[model samples]
Target: MLGNDLPPPTEVINMYKLNQIGLMRIYEPNHEALKALRGSGINVLVGVRNDELQQLASTESAAEDWVAAYIRPYWPQVNFRYIAVGNEVIPGEVARYVLPAMQNLHNAWSSGVLNSIEQIKVSTAVAMSVLGESYPPSAATFSQDTAAYMVPIARYLNSIGAPLLVNVYPYFTYVENPSDVSLPYALFASESAVVIDDGLSYYNLFDAMVDAVYASLEKAGAPQVRVVVSETGWPSGGNGNVTTPSTAQKYNSNLIRHVLSSHGTPRRLGKSVET
Candidate 1:
């Protein structure tokens, strides 16, 4: 999903149908994939490349031009749900462009330049590194250095109806501290003992991680904003035993069931997530 190049449109369509995948996220707008997905009934989330953020953020005209060129051409035919301003670029060198680009894009969409704007939202994606302290879930808060940028982004997201997109990987956590983090806990094993934090029980790492973001939002005075898991997966190839097929299988399968069951994190009980 990160690359601009993709498989043939026909093959992609066939694969999506075969796998019953109703939604897809592409890192950048790949015309071939968009063409293939057109009228396929599959919802898509297209991205703005990090390098192009400066241009888009500089002026509303640039953002409008981008939408006109990349999105309007396939309007109605392609069900684009969100315009991902940037992917996992938060807290990096280009972090400054995240919010501005989102604002410009939102302005463009709301200007009625496009046929449909209500159906599309604007946001950026971030990784767990944005949090200074993620343990205990309740202790989570944006890092001091990044809070200046993150708080505004959160506020903007809350003002609009967009969710804070984040990419969480418990696999990386387990790999980094295998001695302390249990594999079963990371894999969502039903038999694993619940890790109690703030008197609430966390049955798996995914929920705990998600609750951390919620805690951060609450601290930032933007608790109303929702959090969406834009990306998550166990690696099939890596440096250690953490990349085994069986581990990937358990994590992905249980994750699907956990998310689909309408189970929200402890911080937001009964309120389903939009990941």
Candidate 2:
């Protein structure tokens, strides 16, 4: 769902009206929306905007006040499920804020005022760029620079029982090397046979990408951490060469079918993914 820079109250009422029409989830930074839609049944995922992270990290009191003022009052009324501390913090210019934002979020979560802290989850989303190399299946790994930052973050997330959220896009891989990367393979349909560790076979790119993340986590010594794909979708419209509607429909349809079929990965055969 799209959000705005508007203050909490206005955005909350606006979202409530939008929710009535079928937009169930909204991403926002304001707490007033939580209060406005209290008991309204709308799901909200709050964000810690980058600009505010410096302030939030500077002092524990700031984090406490922000949560108490924006989140505490709306408790039990608003369905606050996730607190995303930073967006794409791993591989971009905002890497500096990743640690601090995470620390502040933990402080806020530990504060007893929120009431729903145990039920609510705190996490950060990362872009696919965090992977240093993703091709050839086996060579895929996290960048040394990213690992320098992600290693400790992964440990902390594991310590808090938060899953590592990654945004993967096989479409970009196909677009970048369409000649070698088959569309069906990227779409999670056809079998593109490739053996990894000279034994395990890979049929689709999605699993390959996932396994790459799994490998990174293993290398980081946070092997038990669960990885979640926070975002993955085909664009419905784009330029003639890449974003044509026909290609979009084909990709999306195939993806939906694959997901609904409940086909587990080679590494996780017969084990259905719940989400």
Candidate 3:
């Protein structure tokens, strides 16, 4: 779910079976495993390496070439559902590549790599660092440094009908500020009072975090763009101080139930989120 670089095919298959994971994220597209796992009903999200981003962004030819070599050959055989142009290219040195990478992915799709341009979808995953300030639920907003880039990025993603992918973890938030953040609130274990804004009440941290992103998008003038949670989970094991098996189960189980029970965030009530 985190790293795409995996071991050999046999080992990867065994690991997938061992963990009962139906979905996997791979860095480089692999044709052999795609063929081998065809009937296994596994979903894979592939990526274009960072080094290739600049080339892919700047030239339509490069994207077409990359897709033809890395994607088309394995097409129909591999259940390639999503193609992430680049990973976490925001709010850091890599931020410069975000816009170009997005443009390239869009150009690739427009180039008609697939017989039907409507068949394949592309998106880029972003880290929470993209947010300028995300705290106290209502105060969360995109940072100025990221905003200049995010605004255009969000617009391009919207133009291409791609969801904005983000990785959020309330566990990390709570651990970072235990003195201020309540555990039950972070884990969605609390039935306590909710945080209300503009007459909307947030019942959990997950929804609040999502709404924060939604708000940021609205502020960026891309309110129609959908937000997808590319990653969110609790680790079962970590340094004794931060994590343990018991807490991990409690956190992840409850989070799963919370997501399953909801169709969309308060900001986009009743609307279906790509997730």
Candidate 4:
């Protein structure tokens, strides 16, 4: 959720505790949000913007300085687990700077300044646009044009044991091709029959999309790199079978149940997922 949508930072943390939300992702390291989250016990994944990539990528010193300024001040208290180097950056804009920026940030985290601190995982968020094909949960492949940028990024994430973060929105798919993608499948409801592809049955569009990303990672020769859904939600108000409040409720409720079940996707069963 965007910081603006929430109440004051301290109240936000209180609300999260009240709701039992174990983890939250903040797009930027807003001082108030970080400060409020301090000692709240809720985990956070703070982000670095594409605009800041150039600055952080310029020098190792700059990356270290960023860590010093934004991260260290709210250390063990905030429970910040990951440093998202960039958000939805691939195939359209800021593609070139993604990997280099990640490397510099990771290097900075590993430097002596933060050596005692648990090394925060460094990664970038990618959109489904990076995939050339994402159907059947088996034929997904990285776009050829993005290979130069994606291959190295995948390899680096694999080596560091960091998951590949990708935003998957079934809402967009249904909105774009409502005639083909049914509302039930998109909403994680049982109104529709399961769609079988490559001998695997897909009861929900979310699993299919996630598995498609796994297949793409395999095609990129980064099969060891785990795929994590960085963002996914259905809008409460919009025209269409999938975008209504009822459908959104069903989708979100079922999504929560599916996640808490800890039963991974059909393609990678038994593997736990991080939202």
Q: Report the number of the highest-lDDT candidate.
A: 1
Compute each candidate's TM-score over C-alphas. 0.94, 0.79, 0.85, 0.94
Candidate 3 stretches with Cα past 4 Å from truth are: 1-22, 136-139, 271-275
| Tens-place lDDT digits, model 2, residues 87-205 | 77676677766776677767776757554466666777777788888655457678976987888888888787777777778888778888887877876667557536436677778
Question: Of the pair 3 and 4, which is ahead by lDDT?
Answer: 4
What value does the lDDT take at residue 115 in candidate 3? 51
Q: Name model 4 segments beyond 4 Å from true.
A: 1-6, 191-193
Query: What do the candidate models score in CA lDDT, each in turn?
Result: 0.86, 0.69, 0.73, 0.83
Q: Which residue pairs collide, candidate 2?
A: 238-243
Model 1, 1-275: lDDT tens digits are: 44677567779888988998887888889888888888888888888999999999899999989988888888789888888898878788888988999998888878664635667888888899899999989999999978988999999999998888898899888888888788888998947446788888898889999999999998998989888888998987665677878778888998888877777888888877666
- In terms of TM-score, which candidate is stronger, 1 or 2? 1
- State the weakest 10-residue window (summed lDDT) of model 2: 21-30
Question: Which digits, one per residue and each the tens of the lDDT, describe model 4 over residues 125-177?
Answer: 98888888888779988888777888889989988888888888888887887
Ranking by TM-score: 1, 4, 3, 2
How many residue pairs collide in each prediction?
A: 0, 1, 1, 0
Error of 3 at 36 (Å): 3.4
| Residue 30, model 2: Cα distance from true site in angstroms | 4.4
Candidate 1 vs 3: which has more lDDT: 1
